[model samples]
Target: MAQMNMIEAIRSALDVKLSQDPDVLIFGEDVGYFGGVFRCTAGLQEKHGLHRVFDTPIAEGGIVGAAVGMAAFGLRPCIEIQFADYIYPGYDQICSEAARMRYRSAGEFTSPLTIRTPVGGGIHGGQTHSQSPEALFTHIAGIKTIIPSNPYDAKGLLIKAIEDNDPVLFLEPKRLYNGPFEGDPNIPAVSWAGHELGEVPEGHYTIDFEKARLHTQGSALTIICYGTMVWVAEAAAKAAGIEADILDLRSLMPLDLDSIIKSVKKTGRCMVLHEATRTSGFGAELIAEIQEHCFYALEAPIVRVTGWDTPYPHALEWEYFPGKARVTKAITKMMEG
Candidate 1:
C-alpha cells in the first residue's frame, strides 16, 4: 500500500495496465509528452515508449473516432478528453460508434475503450472548464459511467474500466484528485496522504462496477452520492448530527440497485445528492428507481440537493455549488419529518 493522491493512484493504474497488457494504449491531448494536463500520466510515456503512450491532435471527435477503430482492430485504447466540458465534440462518436460497435456488429466487434476526463468545479475554472456532464454520458445506452471520490477507488475502478469489454466513461472529479473536499472552502484543504482512503495498492487490481461502498452507517437516513459529493454528504451528515448511511457509488451505471434499495429500506428515508444540474440530472433517475423499489419502505419523500439548472456561474461558484449548508438543511428537514 502507498500513500498516494488520486492523480498518483490513477497514474499507477495506467502504469500497471501498460506493463501487464501489450494491447493497452494511452493517448490524448497532452497524455504523451505533457503527461496529461493534470499530470496523471506524467512518467508513463517515457517508461512505456511513444507508440503505446502518445499524444494526439486537439480534435475530440477524431480522437474518439480513431480509438473506436483501434478497439475494433483488437487494441484497447484508454483516451482522455482533457476536460469533461470538451467531451461534447466527440459525443457522437462515443454514443454512436464506440458505444454501439459490439451490439451493431453482432458481437464480432467491441469497443473496449476508456474515456477519462476531469470534471466539476472548485478551482475557479468558470463555465468553460467546470461542468459536470455526467448525465449526458449516463443517458447513452452503451456507455458505463463511473466517478470515484478517493484515491483507492480511482485506481481500482480505472483498472477495471480499462479491462472491461465495453466502452466506459470514467469521470474524475478534479477537486478530489489531490484531496477530499468537504464543501467548505473556508477550511484548509486536506491532502490524501496518510488518509484512510489514500492508501492504494501499487499492483493490478479491479473493483467491480456494480458494487457500492458504504462510508457511514446509520438508521436515520440514506445518502446516495458519488465523486466529490461523497465527501460533502459526509460533512453534511456530521453537521446535521444525523447518523446517515452514506453510499459512495464508484460506478454510476450498472448501478448497485440492490445495495441502494437495501440502504433506503433500512433507513426508511433517502436523499440523492450530486454536483450536476438539478433538472434531468442523474439524480432524477436514482430518485425514480428508489421510488419504484423502495416506495413501500419509504417514510419521507426522497430529496435531491443538486447544482442549479443554469450553467455553472463564474463568480458564484460556491453559491451554485450544493454545499454543506444546503445539504445539512435537507438532512435536518428529512430527519425532523
Candidate 2:
C-alpha cells in the first residue's frame, strides 16, 4: 500500500474503473486538457484517451442531462460538477430524471450515473466555492449521497458508487483533499503522507455501502458525523480529554442505523456534527433518528455542533465553522449533563 491524498486516491479509483470497465467514462469542465481545475483528472485524458476521459461544456444541466441519457443506454458515466456549489443548475436532471428512472420505469430502466463534486470550505473559497449542500441531495427521494473522510475510504467508496446501478452523489470534502483537518484553521492540517488513512491499495477495492466507520471506542460520548467533521470530532474529543466514540457515515441515504443505535445506547450521550448549516442540515436528520431509536437510553439532550444558520462567512470563516473550540465546548456540556 502507498500513501495517497484524496485527489490521488480518487484518480486511482477512476483509472482502475476506466481500465476494468469499458462502459465507464469521465467528463466534466476542465477535466480534459487541464485535467480538472484541481487536477484530479490530470493525465487521465492521455491515459484513457479523449473519448473515455474528456471534457464537457460549462452547462451543468446539459452535462447531467447527457449523463442521464448515457446511463440509460448502458454506460456508466462518472460526471464531475467541479464544485458542489455549482451543481444546482443540474439539480433537475439529477433529482427529476436520474433519481426517478428506476421508479418511473417500474424497474425497467436504471440510471447508474455517478456525480462527483468537491464540497465544504477550507481554502477561503468564500460563499460560492465553499458551501456544503449535501443535505439538499440527501433529502431527495431517490439517489444515494456519499462522503468519505479519508483517502482509503475515498478510493474504495468511489469505486462502489461508480459501479452501482443507481444515482450516486459523491461529495468530496475539499477541506480534506490534501490533508486531514483537525477543526482548527490556525494549526496547519497535517498531510496524509504518513497517516494510516492515507495508505490506499493499488488495485480495485470497494467498501460496503451504508456502513459507518468507527473511529474510537468510548462510553463517555458518541460523536456521529461524516466527511471532514469526522476528523474534527476526533480532534475535539482529544482536546477535551474525553474518550469519544466517533462514527463516520460513508453514505447518507442508506444510513447505518444499526451502528448508530448501538453507539448511542452504549454511550447514552450523542452529538451530531457537520459543516453544513444548522437548520435542515444532515445533523438534524441524525438527531431525529437518534431521538426515535435511542430515546430511552439518552442521559442528556442530544447536542448538535454545526455551522450557523447563515451563508458561509468570507471574513469570519473560522467563526462560522464549528471548530475545535465549539465542538470541545459541546463535548464538555454533553459530559456534564
lDDT of each: 0.94, 0.92
Cα lDDT tens digits for candidate 2, 147-225: 9999999999999999999999999999899999987888966899999999999999999898999987788999999
Query: Considering every candidate listed, which one attains the maximal lDDT?
Result: 1
Q: Write the per-residue lDDT of candidate 1 for residues 246-270, one digit (tens) a residue.
A: 9998888989999999999999999
TM-score of 1: 0.99
Worst 10 residues of 1 by lDDT: 121-130
lDDT accuracy of residue 260 in candidate 1: 98
TM-score against truth, every candidate: 0.99, 0.99
Candidate 1 clashing pairs, residues 3+ apart or interchain: none
- Estimate candidate 2's alpha-carbon lDDT, on a 0 to 1 scale: 0.92
**Positional deviation of residue 272's Cα in model 2 after best superposition, in angstroms:** 0.3
